[model samples]
Target chain A: MHFVDRVRQRLDDAELQHNLKRTRGRNAASRAAAVAAFPDFDAVRARATEIRARVLRDLDLWLEAFEAKATESGATVLWARDGEHACELIIDIARRHGVRTVVKSKSMVSEEAGLNAALEAADIRPVETDLGEYILQINDNEPPSHIIMPVIHKSKEQVSALFARVHGTAPKTDIEALTHEARAVLRPQFLGADMGLSGGNFLIAETGSVAIVTNEGNGRLCTTLPRVHVALTGIEKVIPTLEDLSTLLRVLPRSATGQAITNYVSLLTGPRHAGDPDGPEHMYFVLVDGGRADLVGSDFEDMLRCIRCGACMNHCPVYQTIGGHAYGWVYPGPMGSVLTPLYQGLDKALDLPQAATLCNQCSVVCPVSIPLPELMRRLREKQMEQGLRPWRERLATRLWAWAAARPALYAWGARIAVRYLRWLADGRDRIQVMGLAPGWTAQRDFPAPAGATFRDLYARRRQGRA
Target chain B: MSTRDDILGRLRRQLGRTGSGLAEARRRIRDEIDTPRSGPRPSPGDDPERFIGRARAMLSTVDGCATMDEVPAKVAGWLRAQGLTTRLVIAPAFAGLDWSGAGCEVRAGAAGPHDAVGLTGCFRAIAETGTLMLRSGADMPPVNSLLPDTHIAVVPRTCIVPDMETAWTHARAEWRHWPRAVNLVSGPSRTADIEQTIVLGAHGPYRVHLIIVG
Candidate 1:
């Protein structure tokens, strides 16, 4: 019910509809152009997929290597089995260090764990440093619609309104001015915060380092100025070696924002070493395993190979229409459809698995070549297996199966249904309304049947030939 | 079991691997890390001109310095040309550079917010993306390039790498034990978070000037 309500709200919001149209189109085209410009995209993509596949095969091994190396490099490695544990670890770290404020870069892992609220509950101010994230943070903690561009759901005027109301300045329509407003506000937060929290883009198992990719320099500041830096990432983010980072980076920025490389790609090992004047003195990595470990060696294991590029959603027709908030979770789009069902239980997100049109656009654009549509289909099958799909849908499917098993019955039912649908059309080619399946025709016209079943046509043609 | 053990245990169980060969797999992982594999990299041409072109593409100003002795004067001229202040926060590596010759007073240490320009030397100049790979240390604080409104890096031509893979290989051979942070900055900070429009200088340096020493 909540998901349906959110979908209705997003669909009815004209500004959001316009923005999603522009956002999805521009994002998809930019990614295509970026991929087109790269001459060796196919080969590099192959290498990237190979690297991810290797990690998936031995995820535990890669994680162990990373943990050991991180610890050796003076980073305290913490493991969490769930989101609650992850939040608790970070809060505990803040309490131990007497950290009153945390300057955080945009981290999806932290978002999943609800780290900001936890930090607030612990009496530590958590500042969102990314421009988009800052906008969402100040405006009642709006969840990001798109992972890459969190505020893409809102229009420019909306952001201007929010900024003017919050900063007590005149509403500035220009993005440059609005961006500068955020820069001015967050600079002091970066300079004064006691702890810098970031999400690891890739955890290099060989060197015990965490790589963070960002266009803005907030990631650098969050890790550099603060006395303590804490990187929270999923356990599946680990890679075997630093060389693999180069392979992933080759496609990551290009696929995400159409940049050959983001403005900053920082591979931070442990804390500042001896004789280092700046950078965090204490570095910690809390590797969260919330449902990720369960994904290993499962049917949906390939979902773990996702680089969080958001390309799947950028190209998803369903997402383009309904937007991410309609999915009702942290991750959205095709990847989120699979992830939400698996991570948050299928019964809760049954509509998500069926949200796609199976256009295969998502898989084609995926940097790591994750078969997202197939994954969503698998989620649907899982829902059916668990009896989580709607009872009517299940019954309809079973009745169809029973009819399909009997050739004569199937032909008879199909012929009658086709005639009835043709009559419903009343000589028109398109039916605007259908009594049996009104939901299908609610938004778009359904094509009228040609008044003949496949079996009838086949048998008549065969008899005439004989 | 402790949280760590429980997670590792679940992961191992899902992976269907027993603890019998943990030591062997560890050795293999270490070997894989040590023996570097060069993945496919875009052909970032190996030349100072190519590096300069790429750097410019990333929105950085690249000027050539014929010798290390002329670095300070060049920095001053560039700053004046850009209508910036002559006061600088220089990294410890540039302590001996003659700032007086350029008519500028400079402080040698970590950069501060009030500092208008931060000057430092780069570990490597990546030609692939026109990026500066900065290794943080006492002599070269990462904030020198971050905190200031303007960041100027003097890179030697010998320090240029064709791609990121080579940068790491070079870093491994050079740093031995890696520095705390290795930041690869392409250009000025920009964000497209608002309406997907890129606005430069979001929270870091508004300008990135690269002075290459041949």
Candidate 2:
């Protein structure tokens, strides 16, 4: 079975179709309300985009400056070129600290680097304290299908089952009961963990601070309770100053989840101060490049502007249909389609960029306004240039392009095809199956072409001139 | 030591190649000698109340709670209503509050499993971001705000500030004498991973109740 098909099967078993539909509806309504509520949302987003663009334009300089300042602040900074190196550095830190167990909040970069698996292989256990992440961990599952909501694929029934299995209790379908059960299970992990790990949403170069946003107090506890704290983040997650961070904080939650702000926004500069009563004795920031530096000065540079809001996915029809895991990466949906091929290389994930319908919804709803469809097109073009396009799809696109280049032939072909399609419909006005178009017709019936082709009608209308 | 020198030498070489090392050193020296610009002059349009209102709106979307008077009782009431037990750990900041009249055993110290709820007073609330600040101290153990089934925080009305800038100013002043972990909480623990269903209380407190003490 295909990757998407496997995800579909899981989603079906989990009975998440209704929940996804409801979430999409709620998200749409809330986003609309948030936009309406904050009339300055567009201005804020534009300002944020400018700020990010400026930062990326001079990223090398800013990064070096940040490193220098952070070093001065008594924080150790490690730069990783890719996921493997990132995982290695984090594991090395854990080893040095003799960390047996690690409590963590949500960090997409860590997920992207597959940190947990690496830590486990190194004989270190990493515990996820974020509610959604904790559920995913309990199930021994993959990184969340969504950026903001990791376990958006499971239903209450499935959660109840997972909780029951983990806690040795009978399954309870109530949402409240399931939440309580998870709380009881995770309480012990928080206290016993030796170190805390997190991801920074923004890194302020001005103050050498790592800013993390969370709706849970776990982010705070995870950073403060342990003797060692490690922050793993992508290089692009930096901003020039606190004022710039403020601008982003204003727009991030509103655009992502229709919230004004997340619950907890913690800023950590370095390890505990001399007089501080509680906090980690040691602090480390792992700045992972992971193909981001390559994006600088490139056509796809805007992709780095993402704040991991999952807004584009929420608004995407294809994502709404298939859900996240289909994209076969940490990220999924429209944003995932554009990002996967870029980060993983087009050769490795050729099918991803072609997944979009080019409806342009992702671009419109993006807080940074990334032009995702255009980027996908660029990826497709690159794939074709590399001769990696599937033969069938290549042949189809080639034929369409050829026909389109020859208007006379195209006009005749369109008329003939329309007539043939109408005949095939047999008065039903829709075709249940379309040869060579199974990807489309498999899900829904295609409407038969109208009586007269546009070319034919236009020609007839211009008969007087002829 | 050799590896460290090698890395440093490599960085130094890279800096020399870019011709930015000398410039950067000069810039750092200048920054050390120069004073930072004063806070952006407050505009006439900047209404603290209006800003607070906007910030509150943002906070509420993330499940931030606000209340008035009798914070402990209100918090206890909320927990009991959620079917949580009365056993709780009270922060030293609330030591003077009479919880005996509320009919609950409020122990003052770090939290335990028997403690279903934890209550504490926030040092300040930033209305610009709708965040409640808690600094780690003898009275406020970071775990008391977390690691419990439910968390109840008390924020006095006057402690609320308009934005992060103001909050930073307040924090800087407070941390001048003693620096510790400053926690800014905006709402309860929530996750949207399960089919985008917003589930509250995943790993931390399942529910958070805020009592606004005027």
| Chain A TM-score values, per prediction | 0.96, 0.92
Model 1, B118-209: lDDT tens digits are: 99899988887789999888899888899889999999999998887887888777787788888999999999998788888998888999
Cα-based RMSD of candidate 1 = 1.8
Stretches of model 2 off by over 4 angstroms after superposition:
A4-19, A396-440, A445-466, B1-124, B135-144, B147-158, B169-180, B190-214
DockQ of each model vs. true complex? 0.82, 0.29
Q: Score every model by TM-score.
A: 0.96, 0.81
Per residue, candidate 1 scores C-alpha lDDT tens digits across A108-158 of: 988899999988988999999998899999998888888888988888899
Question: After aligning candidate 1 to the native by TM-score, how far in Å is the CA of A178 from where it should be?
Answer: 1.4
Chain B TM (all candidates): 0.95, 0.74
CAPRI rating of model 2: acceptable
lDDT of 1: 0.89
Assess each prediction's global lDDT (C-alpha) against the native: 0.89, 0.74
- What is the lDDT, from 0 to 100, of the residue B188 in candidate 2? 67
